[model samples]
Target: MAILATEGLTKRFPRVTALDELTVMAGTGVTGLVGANGAGKSTLIKILLGLLPPTSGRARVLDLDAATHGLEIRRLVGYMPEHDCLPPDVSATEFVVHMAQMSGLPRTAARERAADTLRHVGLHEERYRPIGGYSTGMRQRVKLAQALVHDPRLVFLDEPTNGLDPQGRDEMLALIRRIGTEFGISVLVTSHLLGELERVCDHVIVIDAGRLLRSSAIGDFTQASQAIAVEVEDGLEPLVERLGGLGEAVAVQGRLLTVQVPADADPGRTYDAVRDAVCDLGLNLVRLEQRRGHIEDVFKEPVA
Candidate 1:
């Protein structure tokens, strides 16, 4: 079942159209919302969260109408905005507990849940420190902690890795994966970096200029291409000539030769032909593997 769905959703600002007839369905698990800046990713999240009303069309969250059940939807969904929204004077524990209470938790229960959530997010003794004293990674964790503290069924994480170093980004990504896989909470994570999502998302939805570009499983997005790359220890020129003579479209790049495997031809035959060509030229095969497609490939196509 889909946790979120949109039909012909459109949102317009005073002079710009943020979302233009966007339609998409997101299932349970980690679904990535990928697009460049001004691609309508944040606008879509706002609409789905019932914070912004669309100019046209309809949207639903957890099978509830976003237009009519905005308050109810907010209760079940947690949001971590892109920009820093934390209060610098308050400690992480205090802020999280306050958020839980605002979400309708009693004082005692909110404190208990906040403590457990802070621990789960890897915030130990530092969680009691004021937000102004925390590092970038620790602040990100505090943001994540509040989102999960309310025991929300779903979370919308917008640019969770913004302004972090390499190590911090890796840790945040791992925590996001754990939230979806280990905790079983459906996640809609938005990021401008396309390659990063490939490692964490089960499915991806690409949007360009507020329009749906492509939506599919992550595996389908990065399926194997129709070319195989071959590398040899020596006799590069001879192997290229031999492979070209065998009716293969070959392109040389430094020490590697990329051969196009014909669609109508057997793939195994291509592998065998490569092996035979190397053997005939007395060259040692170093590596021969199909060049797999990447999530970035989708951006190369014209927007639909």
Candidate 2:
């Protein structure tokens, strides 16, 4: 049930290769395409949308070959480019309606869908105002509204939270989650931010300079580790000394200490050691919890 896939995809320019033998798949639910700027994320999206031709390899969207069936694929897919492309003088409602009609909706149905989509994105009464007068967040909503207006089966959202404030970013992410869950539309969202993707995506694909790094479910990417995170209010040094004497490995980060759970030892014993160490030093225990992995851990050098 892959909504989009690429096999041995490679795109080369005169001076650099944008994508290099990258193979990946995205199924239903929200999937994140994560990488830094110039990582070929945008280039991959363009190829998938059939907007750019790859130098070699194959790409398919909604089971249609991107090279041969681009028009058919575009009809089923919605794309929101990273950069601003909306007309300044056009009202959101008018713009969305035009886009829906362009997607083959009847004029009357287009208008109705435009209103509904704009409202769903939280545009409200401001949707009738010219795009020129809108804030960055409002402009973003307008772009999102048009993408969803045609009721596309899948959407390629390229940095939908770009230029947004914290609150706006949260709102946009929530909206994306709803599109996949409530509206039943598949989503492929691209971003340089890893944590945001971890929050909303069911699966994530990581790439660097157009090369595939890893692809897996969110849970797999952030599994629990064999380490315990401990924090205390005071007596940190004494607690560290006491834990070391009790045969524990400890790494301190400010107020938190991460103690590793020995491979052959019981985790309960490790927990007990930490508790007894804190109690022996008369330090107020703030937190004692098992450490969990994070998407950022992928970029770190593995512990030997």
Candidate 3:
């Protein structure tokens, strides 16, 4: 079932059009909403959450019309905004319990859920400290904890990894995957980083300039191409020349060489050609593997 959908959805400000005839659908599991800044990602999220109205078209969430059932939808949807909107003075436990209660949980259940959610997000004694004293990663965890405290069926996480370090980003990504797989909550995560989404998302939807660019399963986006990627420890240029001399279509991408396998040619022959070239040059082979597509490849094609 579609968790959320937009049909010819558009939103315009007096000076700018944030969304332009945008239409897309997201189902179960972790679906990634990928686009650059100013790509109308935030606007689309607002419309889906029933926080903002569209200039044209329709949006539905959890089979409820976003325009008409916004209050009920908000009750069942959790949102973790991209920016740091947490209160500086309150402790994580306090803030999260308050949010849970606001989501309509009773005081006892709210406190209990808040504590469990905080622990699930990796907070312990530190959860009692004022949010202002917490690190960026801890603050992000608090945000995530509140979003899950009420146990919503789906979450709209906007750049949850923003301002996180490399390790922190990895941790956050794991947590997101756990939300979808372990907790059984559907996710619609937004990010400008294609690599991050590629790692955790089951599906990806690409948008550019407020228009749909491409939407497909993560496997479809990263399918293996009829090309091999070669890397050598030394004599990179010489290896390229040797492969080209053998009539191979070779392109250099930084330290890696991408050699295309012709439609009629045998893949084993291409592998042999690469192996022989590296051997003749006495260059140390680093990596020789099939090249796969990436979510970033969507930007390489013209918008359809």
Candidate 4:
């Protein structure tokens, strides 16, 4: 089922249409909303959350109309805003409890849920420390804990990896993946970094300057293209030689050796050929797979 849908969803600002007549259906799991700074990703999220009224068109969340069922939708959805909004002096526990109460939890339940959620988001003893002393990663966890405090059906994570180092980004991405796989909560995460989302999202929605560009499942989006990713234990030079000898087009980009799978190529025989070639060269086959296109590659292609 399409958990979220929008049709002709337009949002106008004073000088610009932040979201043009956009239409998209986001299914379950993690769907990435990706674009550059002014791509209307934020605008669309605002409209979906009922934080901003659309200039035109309609949208629905979890089958409820965005306009008519805003409160109900809000109750079932969680949001982590991109910018920092935490109180500097408040402890994460105190802050999260307040958020849970705001979500309509009873005071006792809110406190208990807040503690559990904080622990779940990896804030332990330090959760009692004031927010001002928390590192960027800690702050992000605090924000995420609050979002999950109410046990929402879905979460909209706006740049969850922002301000983190490469290590932090990887950990955050893994956590986002676990949110879907372990908890089964739907996630609609937005990020300007296409590559990072490519690693996490089950589906991707690409926008450009307030216009819908593309929306596709991750499987469909990363489908094997012209480049065939080749892997071997060793003797790369020989495999490269023999493939080229057979008049195949091949190139080495970083760790991947991309070869052209012939137009009339037999899919099953292709791997066998690679396997045989590796045996002939006395090399173990490590990885010989298809080269999947990344989300960033979609932009490189001439916009259709």
Candidate 5:
């Protein structure tokens, strides 16, 4: 089932159109919403959460009309905003428990759930320290912990790794993946870094200039190309010429030669041809592998 869906959704702010007839759907898994800084990713999330109304079109979250059932939808959907919104003076446990109680949990249950959620998010003794004293990674975890403390069915995580270092980013990505797979909670995560999402998302939705560019499974986004990349230690020009002479469509990409593998050509024959050409040229084969596409490729095109 689709966790969220939008059709012809657009949002305008006086001089700028943040979203322009945007349409997309997210299912039950970790879905990455990718785009540049001004691509309207945040606007879309706000509309879906009923925090912002679309200028036109329709949207639904968890089968609830975003316009009408926003209260109930917010109750079921957790959101970790991109920016820092934590209270500096409050401890993680205190903040999350307050959030849980605000979400309508009883005081006792809120406290208990907050403790569990904080621990799950990798906040231990530090959870009791003032958020102002916590590192960027710890603050992100506290934000995440509050979002999940309510036992939400789905979460909209905006730039969860925004200020995180490389190690913190990896750890957070692992947590996001675990939330989707182990906890069985659907997640819609946003990031400007296309490659980062490729590592953890089951599906990816690419947007550009406030419009949908492409949406597909991660595997489909990074499918094997018909071309194989070959890198030679030396004499690249000679190898390129030899491969071209053998009827392979070869294109030079930096130090690598990209050879388009013909559909009807035998794999073994192609390998033999490449091997013999390299051997005949006496050049060292540094690497050879089928090149794969990436989600970033979609953004390279003009907006449609």
Candidate 6:
């Protein structure tokens, strides 16, 4: 099912057109909403969630009209805002339980479910501690716990790793993956970093200047293309010269090398030739893999 969708959706804020004729779709699993800052990613998400009415066009959440069915959608969908909104006075246990009860669960059931949700999000004994004493990662988990406390069917995670460290980011990403695969919750996650989303998202939708740039499965971005990526410890100057002399389309990126092979030509021969050249030169072979385009490649020139 299409968990969320928008068609020519637009939003205007006095002088700025936050979103301009934007369209997007989110299916089951994790769909990545990727764009740089001010690229209209947040505006598009808001329109679909019915938080802001679109200036033009249509949007739907789970087949219901975003304009008319917003109330119903709110019950079925969970939203984890990008910014911090935790109450400093209360503990995670208290906040999540309150959120669950507000979602129509009874007090006892709400508290019970809040405890389970907190644990599922990796918050243990510290959950009972006051929010004022929590670290950034702990606070982020509390936010996530509240989002899931109501047992929502679909979720919108807006930069869940925004302020997290490397370790915290990895932990949050794993949690997001599990929420979709293990818990059966469809998710639309946003990130300004294109490469970061590539690691965790099943599909990616790139947007630029409030317009839809491209939308495709992750495989399309990482498919075996005509370019080959070769890496060695050193002596890339000689390798580039040798490969260029041999009439192979080769280029260097940082410590790695990229050799473009012919479409129908045998990659094995190309690989062997590169291997032999490195061996003959007595250079260390670090790695060799096929070169695939990334989300940033979509922006190398134009998204068109």
Tens-digit lDDT track of model 3 for 188-228: 99999877777789988999888898888887663334578
Instruction: Kindly indicate the candidate among 2 and 4 with the higher TM-score.
Output: 4
Clashing residue pairs, backbone N/CA/C < 3 A, model 4: none
Instruction: Give the per-residue lDDT of model 5 (tens digit) for 1-304.
Output: 9999999998999999998898899899999999999899999999988989889989999999897889999999999999999999989999999999999999999999999999889999988889999899999999999889999999999999999998899899999999999988999999998777877899989988888988888876533335678999989998888888888788998998888766566667677788899888888889987654444555665544
* lDDT (10s digit) by residue, model 1, range 194-228: 67776789998998899988898887663334678
Counting clashing residue pairs in each candidate, in order, gives 0, 0, 0, 0, 0, 0
Candidate 1 off by > 4 Å: 223-295, 302-304
Tell me the tens digit of each residue's lDDT in model 2 across 1-304.
9999999999998999999999999999999998888999999988888888999999999999998888999999898989999999988889999999999999999999998999899999888889999999999998888889999999999999999998899899999999999999999999987777877899999888999888888876643345888999978888888888888888899889999887566668888999878877788889987654444666552422
C-alpha RMSD of each candidate structure in angstroms: 5.7, 5.5, 5.0, 4.1, 5.9, 4.9
Please tell me which predicted candidate would have the highest lDDT against the true structure.
Answer: 3
* Runs off by more than 4 Å, candidate 3: 223-296, 302-304
Provide the TM-score for each candidate, comma-separated. 0.78, 0.78, 0.79, 0.79, 0.78, 0.78
Query: What is residue 283's positional error in candidate 4, in angstroms?
Result: 13
The ten-residue window of minimal lDDT in model 2 covers: 295-304
What does candidate 4 score on TM?
0.79
Cα RMSD of predicted structure 2? 5.5
Error of 6 at 54 (Å): 0.4
**What is the TM-score of candidate 6?**
0.78
Residue 118 Cα positional deviation in candidate 2, in Å, after optimal superposition: 0.4
lDDT of each: 0.88, 0.88, 0.89, 0.84, 0.88, 0.85
lDDT of 4 by residue, 1-304 (tens): 8899999998888998798889999988999999888898877887888878889999999998888788999999999989998999999999999999999999999999999988878889999888999999999999998888899999999989999998788889998998877888999999987777877899988899888888887766533443558777567888888877766677877666787665356655556666677787888777765553455677765554
